[model samples]
Target: MSFRNFTTGQSHGFGGTYLKLVPGEMLVYSDVFDDPNLPGEMTVTVRLTAVSVGTEMTVVQENVPDVIPVEACYLGWQDSLRKLAGLVEPEITG
Candidate 1:
């Protein structure tokens, strides 16, 4: 699926198909952001582990453009995680 602005619902011009999926355990995919700020495709791998109390998640992004600052990706992923948690954690506990 393509990435879109949450507010505008417009395509961000970056899109890719899923490379691998394993139910709740793992997801790996290609994401290409064809913007002036970001000009490359990166492989994203998200792995999940079940814990006694909850779940553990790890996200690894590779082949990111050297021109892109790491801090930008950090902030972007942090925001995404917050949004994701809001969507999933409630159902896990509620």
Candidate 2:
């Protein structure tokens, strides 16, 4: 997917292919950045498990480029997951 940062007016995108998928259980994918500066193929794995209250999800990313700090990548994932939760979780109304 492609994304443009409105604030910085900087744009970059990455393309990924699914390496493995197990329906609702797990998914593995590889991502390659469009920018040459970020030179590396990133492998992302996602796992889903059923719980009494709800589903639990885990994400793991490997082979991240040296240019990006680990903490920054983690923070980015946190923000993205928060946005995802907002979309998937239901609101309780009176």
Among the numbered candidates, top lDDT falls to 2
Q: Looking at model 1, report the run of 10 residues with the lowest lDDT sum.
A: 1-10
Each model's lDDT comes to 0.83, 0.91
- Residue 55 displacement (Å), model 2: 2.1
TM-score of 2: 0.84
Using TM-score as the measure, the top candidate is: 2
State in Å the error of residue 83, model 2: 1.1
Question: Model 1, which residues run further than 4 Å from truth?
Answer: 1-12, 88-94
- Candidate 1, 1-94: lDDT as tens digits: 4566567675556777699999999999998876767777889999999999988989898988897679968887898889887987756454
Q: What is the C-alpha RMSD of each candidate to the true structure, in Å?
A: 4.2, 1.8
Model 1 global lDDT (CA atoms, 0 to 1): 0.83
